[model samples]
Target: MMPLPGPSHQPPPLHSTAKRGRPPAPISPDAGPSHCAWLEPVRNALFTSGLTLDDLVVRSGYSKTRISQLLRGNDYYPSWEITFSVTRALGLPTRPLRRLWAAAAREADKADDWIKNCIDRVVHDGEEPPLPYQAFTDDVRGVYTDYARAFLLTDQRARWVVSQAFDILWVCWNTATASENLHRYAWRLLRSCVIARASRHQDGRPDLRAAVFSTRGIRDPDVPGHLVFFTELIDLLDAITRLPEDQMDVAVLQHLCGAPHHVIARILGLAPALTRAVDHHARAALEAILTTPTPE
Candidate 1:
């Protein structure tokens, strides 16, 4: 397998693509809903906190226009600095808010360093993230990242989604560890984070059409013959998306990533036999789909 790109991986600029003097374009249609979803909690917090706009301007140290735009989900996704400022002013926990902000930033296609640097500025009361959580991240971060990138189709997005998942895991570390299986709980969390951001077909199942088209790796291949394989790969990926959720997960982690069945079972917290069964069913389904004749 290819090496995962480091945090420095830079894709085309997201909201910052406009000429220097011109304001960046409005958030795309696809990103608007996600941006608003992340803001919902912040809006609720502001309402219940009984703080007025003027009060937030004073407490957050941002101009009223800036706070209003941030609250309204306008122009661009807000930076963590402003988000943390407003959330702190409202006396909310920073951990969960950071997770939401990270997700929104990824939707906006914000750079990895931009997210990290924004998060780094938040004062954690001199408290480090829990040591056990740190250890847990070290354990599954690799497979988790590859699993995500397989769906998201880019190193940058996969990294952001995984980063957000870890942020969420850190926030709920106690509950996660106390659950019946830590691996299962973390896996479910990670799965949800990726699926929530995945592009979708008209049927609302996860789709890779956008990722497959936009990815530069396929467009600029290192080998000539790889282009012929890419056509077949697209069909295979589409078929995988058509599987039931459990079967899809098993297929991707097992067949796509080359993870051993035992490792898959451990990560999914399924019995080894059941994991194999799901993979078996997934393969059978894919074969049926691929072998069926197309209409003339």
Candidate 2:
């Protein structure tokens, strides 16, 4: 039998183009709501706000599979895509994120509406909310500047990047968590690095690691094994050590390290076309660095 001609008056059924599948699963007890304690509330809040995982996937500009995984309660590191999408979708003001940042998940539930509560907190944060720790700035600065500098490197750019990185570390390590004592530490670290590198002509190369860490004061605590860059950064730094000096490319270094591209671009002031070239050379250098022999 022949199908009838397409509808003469009405549009064809949407099913003609729609995927064949059951409707998405609704929230179910069996789904056991993903535990990730920090993310659970955010997920619930999104669900109750006339949104769904599919909506999140579309709005967040993430792949459908990725959003599904996130809804399953896995840990999510906030990024530009998720941050911008959620904020825009919910129509959040500039400051709502701050309240969300500081409020405990349960407290978010206590409020009648998370959105209203966030707005109220934003309006009042200037008046009565406790300010973030002064040290928060230093701590954050320490982490971010290193990332910034690592991506802006050239021989000329090197010292400036080092300087910026040193600025944060110097303040964070040598001074009280409050006072920015970076001046002395910055100078000392840079000078020490220069001296160690310069003196390598004699002692077959100084122990740069020892030199870098030793200046942190007598009580200089060991850097946490997973800190700063976590595992990826540590591995990348190791890769840098083995790469040939001339082969290094800051752009490539960031990619292999999983550093954000926009951030690296902002740091280097280079156009977008350079990304692949930078990534390729940087990866090659990293591989070489991993295999380089240290002069004993």
Candidate 3:
């Protein structure tokens, strides 16, 4: 049966490709509704305590602009040093702020520890590890085999496939709150596993396949430098296939054009006949997704 065209599941908009160093926005007089009452106390405390911006800057090692922005009411969300320096600068003996400071310090420590635990779980002595997201392979299998049993058209294949893909996302999302680096690694890891999961039935795309798992293991131009480079390339390819039109995104396209097909096919389970179809499908999907309107 002819597959229906898939919905464009473009990734969320990202920050500008340029490096992030946005200038502090010009503070509106109307800005910062909640902290207005404390502004005078905070400012007067700075003066009475003899804690100049220079002193706080020197102690915290934060830049002049950062200190200036925090103090002049230009910014309200205070940093660790800003808050602490104010407390110490004021010589406040109050137990309330001290408790708050302790909680903030504890939260920061917890974030660090949480990430370390995830790292330990994901990477063993030195080998690639079995990831939690691989459980979604069941979803992939069930969708292909059992989805036809449901009322929807096989054309709706893209919808179900994309939905199951969210499980991999959940695994990564849960891990991200603890350690972003680990989350990134897990995301890439899941991408690769997903290719293998879906590849069970497809015909194949030889050149793309060779690139995904070449025994020779040449460093391809399209692959990213992170830990899961090889498998991610294949998963990017598989994502193209599972879509209604069978295409990859620009992010995924970069990976696809990099390597040979047999490698991609083996890793992603692409069939012998479907390679060219996948390539075309990926390109078209990108176009449609790029132009589609999104919900608020």
Point to the candidate with the largest TM-score: 1
Worst 10 residues of 1 by lDDT: 10-19
Better of 2 and 3 by TM-score: 2
Estimate, for each residue in 1-296, the C-alpha lDDT of model 1 and write its tens digit: 21222335312211222222322223345445456545654565455445577877876778988887887777778888787777666555566667677767886899999988877776453237778888889988888988898778888999988887776666456557767999889998899889987888888888854445543457678856677667777888898998988888888887566788888998888999989899889999999999998779
Best by lDDT: 1
lDDT of each: 0.72, 0.38, 0.39
Q: Candidate 2 residues 36-103, lDDT tens each?
A: 22233334345435555566565556676665554452333333234334434433322333333323
RMSD (CA, Å), each prediction = 12.6, 22.8, 22.1
Superposed Cα deviation of residue 169, candidate 2 (Å): 20
Task: Please say which candidate is ahead in lDDT: 1 or 3.
Answer: 1
Residue 10 Cα positional deviation in candidate 2, in Å, after optimal superposition: 80
Backbone clashes in candidate 3 total: 31
Please rank every candidate by lDDT, starting with the best: 1, 3, 2
Residue-pair clashes per candidate, as listed? 0, 4, 31
After TM-score superposition, what is the CA distance of residue 150 in candidate 1 from its true location, in Å?
Answer: 1.2
By lDDT, the better pick of 2 and 3 is 3
The sequence of per-residue lDDT tens digits that candidate 3 reaches over residues 1-296 is 21211234211222223233323333447433223223333444454444556655654456677666655555344543354444333333223333333333343343645434433332112212135434544334333223221212233543433343343334233333344354234334334333423324346421133334432233554544543665554544444444542244222423423335553343334553565567666667755654566568
Question: Candidate 1 deviates by what RMSD?
Answer: 12.6
